[model samples]
Target: MIAKLTDIEALEAKGFDAAYPQKSPWDILRHQAETRPDKVAIRYLVDASDPARDEVVTYGDFARRIMGAAKLFRGLGVTPNASVAILAQHTPSAQTAIWGAQIAGRACPINPMLKPDHIAGLLDAANAKVAVIMGVNGELDYWSALVPALREAGVTIPLLACDADAQSPGADGVFEEMIQTASGKDVQPEGDETALAAFYHTGGTTGAPKLVQHMRLNEAHVARSCAIMHDLTERDVVVNGFPLFHVAGAFVYGLSTLSAGGTLIVPGRLGMRNAAFMGSIWQQVERYGVTILGVVPTILASLKATPIDADISSLRWLLTGGSPLPTELADAVEKHTSVPVRNILGMTECAGAIAVEPVHGTRTPMSCGLRMPFSEVAVFGETEGDADPSKPLGPDETGIIALRGPNVAAGYSDPARNIGTFLDGGWLVSGDLGMIDNEGRLFVTGRKKDVIIRGAHNIDPQMIEDALLAHPDVLTAAAVGMPDAYAGELPVVFAEMRQGSQAGEAELIDFLRDRIEDPVALPKRIGTVDEMPLTPVGKIFKPTLRAEAIRWAVGQAAEALGVEAEIAVDEKLSTRVMVPGESVDAMKDRLAGMPIKLSVEARS
Candidate 1:
């Protein structure tokens, strides 16, 4: 039985099996290690820019690192039952840390790049007893004192700083120093494979992040789902360009590729130098005939911006996820390189892809393909009045996507959030607004939560303001995604200055640079407003602000580069703003054609 958003009221949890075959990500990893121990598991291009010293790890060695790191964590007084947290970066060390956590016992991967307050909140929320922070030289906190403050906030968990040297004052233990943290002893997990594999917090409409408890079963299911789509094999050399913290980078795409006994490729970052890295990717492809590779939408878009002369002819597959696959960009890549671009849709809780277009399959612009085996999906009628979740909707109907299979989460870390996100039906509400077509293709329609995806990075506007407000002269600020041509969206800020105190835009930008690690997470452009746009509920009316931003953006575009007489601008606007991707004439015509309507669905 399949459940979707159309008729969510009718779903029930007793409809499916909890313990099914093809479960356990660890089981899959172990299987690959035993079967193809000699096979090259990952070919990490240390610095894609530097070709001379590319490193490779065999399946046997990769498995050993995981086990070794797991043992190391236990030996360091991070007990089995106690929560051990790691902020996974975009490097191979990130992968080792996550896999090691699972081997140790209870592991929950958190985005270490998040603001310190949120990091503190998540650490507190997880009740972590020990944190294996990336060390000072290895640590991202080179300038700021966020780490010290975290320790002060009762996050007195043993902090083992891990840099290249792995030595720093105030450090409880270095990872290498505690190679025998657990010695030959391994902590037995409190729950069996069915207990919980890991916890990942996702954004909710309530503006709070909910911790999703992915089960051991779904972990394997998502991995298999990804492995099958790309025809993952021991010969394939995979590139790990996406953020390891994201589900796509961690499990669905990253682990699945590694689990297949293939060569894993880790690029430094998905920015300007990516094309140069492609030369390195081509070299690995030529050296090992690297067949399969995964790319986030951001890197793909960046690759599209500058011309690539390197022969991607060695490329057999190009799978894209984390955001919608823009058709024009996808087409541009295919036109440049012969590799077919497949759109994949999966979530952190699902473990891997729920659906992915077949390789060399028919291109459908932005179609997220059919559901994997044992996983049922459907579309429902939103206003159908008590709709059935078990039944699939007919053609062209739009609704939320619900999943019931081995690949879904068991429960959440927070008990309160568990009730709303998941119901008595055992169906996780996926908050993503999407629709399934008659042919079973899923199209992501919209997001229920007001999140802004700027260059494939999930930046909650509120999450951004959490940093901006720290500036004494800054009264209040709002974070928004201004439309972009190649970048998709750029972060912008609407802020107010404090009375009797003043701060310039450049000064505020510098202040944020001191506080936040990822400069992109902070607002690129700042505008002072009399008052912030807010809803009656007091949550900043982000939608209204987004609209204003868009309108201002379109107007600026028109004013800077004059538009036709049919489209005139309101001269009162000084700040630059971007509208949703729409032509000026189209938007003007839309406004011109509309007749304002007032309704009383239920009188106020």
Candidate 2:
């Protein structure tokens, strides 16, 4: 599974007769083209209302598109060391462009949701000489945002619009038109497995986004592992709902199915917000005979809310990630839909998901799953004053999760961030807290930064959240730490109730009191909300919760002191306080009296 040197040589001769057989991601489609040219490689839904409008492409056609893109890039002077940025939705041309860039140079997939200025900074960071993006529409104005970003960065890159609605104002050429005009003949098929092939930026939740460097083999290895876990075959049809910019969408759902010679289904530019498309998801699955489906917890919740009568007998399993799936919700979904839900755990640093529950294997409730065969996982902790901070913890002991594998990213763009990240044994610190159970199943407790310190005791918010989720009335729950004058920090729970369920704060509090025995771990306050703020990938946005808690704390302090105060918390958990008509020293003293450590800024 690690693809040793011996295995790489075997892969060339035994499997697929790959052109660039050092385990490059492109060889999957290449192999399929040779063996199954007439078979459907990609079946994309352009419009949900009309199934006849589905765009179908054969493996042979897909190969030609990839070659055409590669030819176009070479003509544009792209070299093996250069990089090309792609900022478009789910389309054959966009996907082909990614392969072409990887073959000729490096492919950088920028999240289209980012602001124009942020996109410009990333493009500058990657030094992209060319870009592919969607043109402006009534809904998405990607062209309008990208043009300014390119100009502001002082970059003169050629912009290729893949989804040009009307004639793009700044597009040098349309993607489809260029592919049709160019000859895909006489293209070189050279690839280096160790060479950097793609660059993905982190979510920047902790700080500014850092570029994650990935070699071709890293993606290929994980995709193979995913193929095995899903038990995919030529008979299987897989659908990807996640954006192509995400690792789950591109690598797990896209490349993995291709490796298995299975058809890949996509919904063009349709995301979780597309209510119409989402409403007809079951119908789409039945129409396509989709054997595998990828989703997140938020999407699952929405599907559960809006029930649709459709035959889902073809679905082998519901692969869910991007957030933790509560046991209660998982059971409810299975009971309602009769499809098993498998929880997966992964991060960008690992090139995508590193663990998944097997299709017909035993799954522990709320457990993320077992580590993939290609990766080495361990729980590590730091000891006070110990010279070596990367000491491994025993099983069932909570610590920072560490992983080392061929699937892991080579390193970050900034070498400084690489020091503490990679340990002496090549283990990459995951920054997530988890423990391995006796059965070797991985259980994610929470993020390292998400741990709440209540009167010097470490309290994991995930425990409280899980307890609340067990209640039948509770739909989705999130627990965070609220700054407290006495306890340093108190656990607070925010939940969204099931529709028509009349669960109040006191009722939830009493429910938790019966479930959680440890007082320190119990939520001090319970509040109900209509919905929880989620990240692009559908994970709970804890930073937003932390900021709201700080604001609430500041308001309470201001009311007590009869003065205005401003508060902010940064990624390092550093607190900043500003007070008008008060000395910095006086404010600091007052905060210190409340057992708080904060930097006081004087108001101008």
Candidate 3:
């Protein structure tokens, strides 16, 4: 086994292909099955309420199941060029579908929480031959609602149900039954390093979804790199609650653990969404002797209130990503659990990893740690004349972060979407704004689009968020640009206070006055929410806040004109306000100076 990654340069010197010989995920699993067949590969909880109610799959059984899934898909007419779309929770069968589909064809795991039309769009985009959906299981009945919706959306592909119950209907076959009966003796992996392994949709709230094509080499390299970064081995047991559709679940936490022959314990069907599971997460860790705990920032934030009820000495590292890790939040988690929190920088285009804080390394204040082995991460100028990748900015110069490595995906499925991002020389231009420090650690500042433009000044919302998060009573904070008629846009903050903290918005605003450096960056207003809106993957949902900000701005503008305006924000976030014809001129005048385009309709 490769030594723990203390120095990235040393790992790169050994050469990526030479150090990690496993070319595909199947290769890794096959090696484990051959060497240690009886070792537990997966421990899936049947019910999150009771940790003891679980199912186990050994390495040998998992390998055979993967092969069986491949054979079953082949029997269903799946080809390497075609895809098997999966709309299910994280179950053993779902895991089988992911790996098996990859071996037989391509795996396309869709977010089951998405609307039917969106899911159908992804299916069409992937060129899917068959779909594996989660069957009815009590309150978790995605099969009951989704199957009909998919059919209504004109999805005619053959559907299979995983963990199907008697109440579940409309699927052509059962995933587990077919896999168990299929012959796995002669089935083999069909793809190679360059072959497409999966299609992961980018989580854009609007527009047509872009499917990132992960090559077999991309998955292999990332999984191996993550295993090395975390010092993962057969002894380690990771508890990964991330959904299958997300790269963090499949590659960062799921495959990385498997690649090292470690056991992966997945929470029940609801995964991290299961409130009962989250409440008893520490107990579950102790029950399973979980070593590596993977979570997003939102989950980390929520853990602050959850009392550690059991001995969690088994946990070595707490990994967080999918959003920026607030330094305060990291500090809080570390203090509470006595476990180091390692921040990760990843994206779907890179098969989940770009940079990961080494478990053995000292934690940097806000750094996402070193780049992946044999990968180049540089900060390029974002300006028009200086945006060339060849002219990367010097240390500490913040700009567009770009990556080039074997782990980077082979561009998006729609080639047109690759124009600005997938550039020449194998570089994937990440839209994120970041800086590589002198020590080679990466610090993501914010996204290019996330910058709030207040006339000529470009303000990063993170600066405001970081400032507000420093407050003791604030549990979560988000900064957004509130529409302003005079300044084009002004900074505003929304914060969720810790439980039992009576601190109000005015008190938080007063707290930020001294913390924020820039006068322009200081929030124009502060609002407190009982609970902050979060994405399924646990990132702060900024779009929802932005919509709320827009409504607040319209309300203020209409109030100035002495008119009641009804506001409507479409899926695209285009804001339209309607008022009486008499007040149209005054309302338009009030909102004229704002940069945001507003449709002011004069009601008859």
lDDT of each: 0.61, 0.72, 0.82
* TM agreement with the true structure for every prediction: 0.77, 0.72, 0.75
Q: Which segments of model 1 are wrong by more than 4 Å?
A: 1-22, 49-52, 138-146, 163-166, 180-182, 185-190, 204-209, 268-288, 381-393, 462-480, 492-521, 525-548, 551-604
Q: For model 2, how does the per-residue alpha-carbon lDDT over 399-518 read when each residue is reduced to its tens digit?
A: 878888777888888777677666666677766778988667788765664666553244557668877899999889988877664454678888989999887888889898756534
- Model 2 clashing-pair count: 0
The TM-score-based order of candidates, best leading, equals: 1, 3, 2
Residues 233-336 of candidate 1: C-alpha lDDT, one tens digit per residue: 77677766766557877776777776566777776534124556764545555555657667766666655544554555667877877666766567777776
| Deviation from native of the Cα of residue 274 in model 2, angstroms | 2.7
Off by over 4 Å in 2: 1-22, 184-186, 189-191, 205-209, 384-390, 449-604
- Winner of 1 and 2 under TM-score: 1
**Candidate 3 backbone collisions, by pair:** none
User: What lDDT score is found at residue 343 in candidate 3?
Assistant: 81
